[model samples]
Target: MKTNILSLTAIMVVSLQGFSSALETDAPETITSMGQIAEIAHATQEFFWQLVPPMDDPLYIHPDGIVRAVDWKKFKNKDFTSQMTAEMKTVSSSMYPVYRLTVIETRTGELLWHNSLDQLVWQTPAPLDYNPYFFAFEHWNVDSTEALDTQNLLWGRSSNVGAEILLLPEAFMESYEEDVALEAEAAALAAPMAMMLLSPPTVTNLMLAIGVESNEVEVGVYFPSGYTNPVDVFVCSSLMDWDWSLFTNVSSVGISEFTWIDETATNSSSHFWVAA
Candidate 1:
């Protein structure tokens, strides 16, 4: 009887151990892939673009047929003309693309003067005085006094012609460093998420965490289950800013998990996690 009792006790312990091991083996957590992180990054960018405003501004035109305002005094002086000529030469040497400046007499619709499309320099028939207003269009350097003179001629002449000035718009202007810096903040946030999509299939789960305080920023990922080995993570950030548009600072986190299981057990509870 004693022997039978001891045997039954040993059998019960063995059965309990087997049951516990079976329960552990029955449920396995799944690993996440890098592709999922990329999808999230793309979606976030699309959302940001849609939320931003258009970058272009309205054209500046005078009541008369001039595209810009002109200052006659600067054009009339010999010293001013010489300085402007030298500046124009420097601008030409820069190999910048030429823009046409068209001066038209609105009353007769006749072209009065045209400058080289390759060179913005203009030899005015005479130093401009307040009279005989004219309208003009040209690609003028934003930094050049000569360009300012051209713009002034257009504006001053338009005032005389009593015609409205019209200007063609450009798609993009100059980039601002400050704007780029701000945009970089957002890009840095999104890049990690994008990097996740570059991983292989061994990953089954991933998690991302981002935090920022004052000037300090932190990013982390958690891999609680599925992956048997440590995975690599990459992060990147770039700054870009343009004169016409605004960008929001964005931050993102990405994670990837990996696992190994038999093909036949793929659909079984052993291959995935279950929440209570």
Candidate 2:
């Protein structure tokens, strides 16, 4: 039939070239490691450590009670995201650490001191409610010496960027029975809070200013969610302006500074802090 109509038109041109190569496709996209999920992004809730201090290994205290001692070592987060494999801490932390002590009177709500297990280890993950004019007193003419020089303008802006603290450093009263590095920094502030947050505040714990000097900051409150209302937590380190009360409002606001991550190699890997 003319060679069977050219073999039935070569089998209908190889079945329409296998149906137009199966409707033209590339077929790529199968990579996945969707291991961790439950993402609601923007984190950093619960963490209120009153008058926060202890960047690490400190139990030191001595407005004069005496107990000079020392020996310890060191330590991120934000409206925090944590894509940690199958692990995390976007905020809901506890690697384990608790041990507290308070010596109030930063300007009333006065407890003025504690010890003998500080009324059972101070315990205040919540419930403080402060406000003795909640810092920097936002005008009634902001007294308390401009509300402690506006909370010593946070270590004079910690490297500086001011509105007024004018070079923070003037209250290191040495005679706490003759200082031994302030009795090894008040026996390193009673140690806990995960080992005083790995120690790193030394502009000199000055305060009670006579020359506008103050340092010994460690404030926290960051809530960002959970039906909102905490207010960027910081009263005596200036921030929460505008006359709202209840101890410097407090919720959160971060990004202090300092970043290295980790290090080791020095075969031109290099490190020198400043060694003459």
TM-score of 2: 0.17
Q: What's each prediction's TM-score?
A: 0.16, 0.17
lDDT of 2 at 49: 21
lDDT per residue for candidate 2 within 36-138, as digits (tens), equals 1000000100011211221221121211111211111100221111211111111122221111222322222322223323332121121276544432243
Relative to the unseen true structure, what is the Cα RMSD of model 1?
Answer: 32.0
Distance from true location, Cα of 177 in model 1, Å: 35
Give the 10-residue window scoring lowest on summed lDDT in candidate 2.
37-46
Determine the C-alpha RMSD for candidate 2 after optimal superposition of all C-alphas: 32.2
Q: Which stretches of candidate 1 lie over 4 Å from their true place?
A: 1-203, 239-276
Instruction: Report the number of the highest-TM-score candidate.
Output: 2
Q: In model 2, how large is the Cα lDDT of residue 233?
A: 17
> Which candidate leads the pack in lDDT?
1
lDDT of 1 by residue, 16-96 (tens): 011111101111211122122223322332222211222121111111221222222333444422322111211112322
State the C-alpha lDDT per candidate.
0.26, 0.21
